[model samples]
Target chain A: MAAVLPPQAAPHEFLRARTRWHPLEIVFWLSTLLPFVVVPEYLQLASQIAIAALFAISLDLILGYAGIVSIGHAAYFGLGAYTAGILSKHGIGEPVVLLVLGAIVAGVVGYASSFIIARFRHLALIMITLGICLMFYEAANLAGWLTGGADGLQGIKIGPLAGTFKFDLYGKTAYSYSLIVLFLCFLLARRLTHSPFGLSLRGIRENAVRMPAIGAPSDAHIRKVYTIAAAIAGIAGAVLAQTTSTVSLEVLGFQRSADVLVMLIMGGAGKLYGGILGSIVYMVARDQFSGINPQYWYFWIGLMMVLVVMYLPNGLLGGLEKLTARWRRSPT
Target chain B: MKAFSLCLGGLLAAMFAASGALAQQAVKLGLILPYSGQFADTATQMDNAIKLYVKQHGDSAGGRKIEIIRKDSGGIAPDVAKRLAQELVVRDRVDVLTGLILTPNALAVGDVSAEAKKFTVIMNAATSIITTKSPYMARTSVTTPMLNESLGMWAAKTGVKRVFTMVSDFGPAHDAEEGFIRAFKEAGGQVVGSVRFPVANPDFAAFVQRAKDSNPDGIYAWVPGGVQPAAIGKALSERGIDTKKFRVMGQGELTSDEALQSLGENALGIITVFHYDHNLGNKLNRAFVQAYNADYKRNPDLFSIGGWDGMHLIYEVLKKTGGKTDGEAMIGAAKGMKWESPRGPMMIDPQTRDVVQDVYIRRVERVGGKLVNVDFDKVRNVKDPVKARMK
Candidate 1:
């Protein structure tokens, strides 16, 4: 009965658009299967890349879609890692149970921290998140009896997946386990980003002040996304713990958070597939370049990052998307 | 996305091409060490030591020519070490694995070695428990506790009644401090006070001040790596604490060749204990040091000795097993084997698979205007009590 449409019509449009499957999505999922057939030896590397990608995607959920810039994302990751490690060390070595437990613990912490984080904007949020991560880092370091101090949480024996398919030295089981987790998480994230709630998050990200005028509880929406993102991050960490069977102080380190941030940016933030693509690129490049000259690998990595940031403002995926769209539009 | 995938595929192809050059008949020894960053200097020296040994031995152990493939673990990140260890095992198909400076990296690699059923020889990591993590693992290097106990006992015996202890706040530091304290207490020496400083602390004046305030006869210190020991020596000298008046005793790295270079006269007369000394006055050590000095234009350090001994251990085992790369056979050959190393005679304890070697107590002295460790006392067949006590 409305004569004219409101300014924010995309949330309604998103519902209809979500039903059709994107060809790119199918292609993306299918490509992951290639590693199993093509290079079975690099399964461990592939698994690590998947874990890092998941972490980057989690960061993207908050930073890219919700407009919450976090430099301390490792807080959730470390929490999840320690949770999985401690549980497995105590004999609860089932992968699913560990992932769920890790996610719950990290999600709870994220939800609690979200209340405080959602109130702040920009630099204050960054500082608070960094402070929280630092506190956890120190706690892990000081709790030597439980966490093994600086020596790392060792003696973790992760059992078989579904009581079958043992974690082989070749990492076939771990790769499949992480790939399936990543795929499921990606599907849920895809649904959320296309839903009304996700549209509201994007609305909040674009213009927070205007979002309030449109009757959206901006803080609550951001908080929900942040908690969801943190749960995903925890899952990534749990996967890492299960695959590696050990967690060191590096999980809680500032470097981990920074690396994820870099990965998210390089892959093109905002889009669902950007983080995974970016992780594949960054981790693979690092692996190759580090083998060439381990001492000066950072110099090469820095140069590549600079070139990407300078040339592609939206990131690698964004630039590629632009190129493909232009090609499709051109009279070829 | 397709373009990116194409690029990645190309890169992977290139990497595979580069890696496929190794011959199937050669015995590939995979060395994973930090080639850059904080531990790079020591790691490079260790690499050089291994290379020197191979070059001197005509590059053949038993009947097989050794081919070394190096992988850098970067730093202490266990995940990186674990991934690289897997790659070396599955992809590279390395016959033997060795090298890791950090304890965590060694532990991670040890786990990989155990899981993959590969023989891994540890050269530098001093964590006592690394030996127990994998049955396929053998440590040619000494543990922190084994290196420190001798100094502690010698200090107690040589009129150091009450001593103040200091160590950097980390795992190996804790091991060193605890080992020293235990032996000192057992030898009836009182621990006056102890303080742990943060790693890479720029200034040790406060710690030195605390030691002075403790009014102890000696100060037993365990500082972390990389010029910190030299800085501590400088700080002690600046504070005017004469070694003769109040003894400053610690592990060998406290006044090692690198520390002595920066320490100079300040480190002179300071007594410390270690498993390896450049001036051990033995035929093997003298030749090794001469060759090492001629090759690197620098003196040999603890890490260098570890790597040298590691090569010797591997060669000896290979000879015994007739160049067999079978993990069980290699491990069996290495067990309870004793050899005269550049440092001293060392034996692999069958129970622990860790080295039982002679620890030398050395005093820093200036010989011909060059500072070096002079062996004043020695403890023969010293074993790691921590490992002995492990169930």
Candidate 2:
């Protein structure tokens, strides 16, 4: 199709068209900022939601778009956390510098691991990722001198955001900082997903056997996406550690990996907004349910998951798409 | 319809204003605990004690009306605990923070308390360095070194010379193991062998076999007060390392009533040390146990005392400050405060703001047709050795 295109044709014009911002997306982003005005007391929770959304997006990149189903995605997230936490503990308190360092370290690890990860699929891939996650968890557990083990990485003194906005008792600075990072990362993810590289990942997901024949190099695409996904997850972890100023073993626990996967699946996969939307629902529901009945909050969460899966297998975004399908542009 | 709706909205606004005014003067204490998940029973025991204390002593402490607010952390989630503390401070305007059940969660809230200057009381978290994290913090719970080190010193002092130590691989267990080892070595006792089993459920047969193979006169083991203790007890008996032949000793929880139930007669000779036990028959403790059992229909564990004594400390501080709930007043009044608790005489050490109390060495014995920790020996005025060295 590209070879037969006329001189006046723009390259990947359909991709650009799909990437164009929906009016609702603009409204959604603006509404995120509304918590600052309307519910400033929940700034800490809002910030946590932002971090979770970023993490879910990272998972969606590989699992949703690249056809990789990883339950141990928390490996990269925890890696990023420990990286930032260790740096802060040692007096490298600058948040941005630690964040970038966290990304680089996790991205490198992800790139190396992807060599093995790219070869496997389905059950083997799930077990391999879970095994890797357990290794990191155990490593953190054993290296109590460095990682602080189950006691958590303590004495982490994260500096003020941009050397100006101190994280106050009200969490004004932390929420804003997380929101900014989340926004920038969201933009990068959106741009990445709409590119020819992202299209190759989709093709690989849909038809791995045919994608290699079409010169897409399925392994390379999968590996690249996995690396980026890990890097993004690292950023999310860094954000969490920086904002909270602590990292416990739970960051790398099996529960964390499982929860993120659940959030992504509940939000829907493949489409870009599914992960973010799912995080919002899941996090908010958790906060509310736990508030109402902390002892049995998981029961409510489980019920919601069952309901979402049963009624809307495609997730909240999938349901929304169906409702608004008639008004939107049809896929070419 | 519009007039009726307007009337209903006005009534609602008036009710909100009225309730807000009523809640304003009440002294709010935010209780954060793992009220769900694996630690649910721990939370329940402590919470039940808190309720018992409130029932015995009227809710009002100092000059103000008391209000209790509960937040369930669910587990060792430091991030969630910190957020709950923040919410307690900013949203609920709580005057004090309490009921922190995990060390990491306590440390996390310590940051919040230091920043917010809210007087925080450690209820059950026992890590020694935790109180050092916040100036406004004081601990009612006993530290690992306080109990374990004393137990080790006594063991060496009495008769146990050669020992093998086996404990769970975690911070508290490591702390306990180190204190026991150091104290025993200082007293000229030789440690035959030591190993940290996996933090979670370890294969008891293998671990018990390894300990037995060491061929030591004494086997010191430390695990949390849970199902693991019973399993370890069963494993030890199965391996023929009975308390009768080889001296078995550890933290008090090893021979808890539930562990006793499972171990039956095997739990009889096991020796352990701790600050509080439901079976301690002191006058105050008898009263407390009677009341607790009457109300909750169960024996209050070590956690129950921490919660009970913590509430008592709050009441005393409130009375001292004449109901001043500010950080400075509450913490200042709390320091060096001596009180008679069900645990016996306990003082909030003025220097470290950690608990100083009597640690009793008890033998689990059959009394009145049930297993009970019979207090046979004691170490008095014991400070958390780790923090005692600091100042």
Model 1 pairs whose backbones collide: none
- For residues A1-332, could you state the per-residue lDDT of candidate 1 as single tens digits? 01234557664664765645778778888999889889988999999999998898899899989889899999999999999999999999899999999999999999999999889888998899899998999889878889888889987979999997777777888899999999889888988887888889889888887898889999889889999999999999999999988799889989899999999999999887889989999999999998887667888999999999999999999899879879877977
Across B211-270, the per-residue lDDT of candidate 1 in tens digits comes to 998888899988865689878888888887987556888887787666777776778788
What root-mean-square deviation over C-alphas does model 1 reach?
5.6
Interface RMSD of 2: 1.1
The two-chain DockQ for each candidate, comma-separated, is 0.53, 0.57
What stretches of model 1 exceed 4 Å from their correct place?
A1-10, B1-24, B200-206, B226-240, B261-265
Tens-digit lDDT track for model 2 on B54-119?
A: 999999987778898888897888988999999898788788999998988999999999998999
RMSD of each: 5.6, 5.9
Model 2, span A1-332: residue lDDT tens: 01233546576666667677878889989998999889978999898888998999999999999889898999999999999999998989999999999999899999999999989888899999999999999999899999988788888989987897677777877898899999999899888988999888888888888998888898988889999999999999999999998799988988889988988999998776888889899989988888888678899999999999999999999988776675554653
In angstroms, the error of model 2 at A126 is 2.0
Q: Residue B25 deviation, candidate 2, in Å?
A: 0.4
State the TM-score for model 1.
0.91
Q: Candidates' lDDT values, in order?
A: 0.87, 0.89
Colliding pairs, model 2: none
List TM-score per model, in order: 0.91, 0.93
Model 1: number of backbone collisions: 0
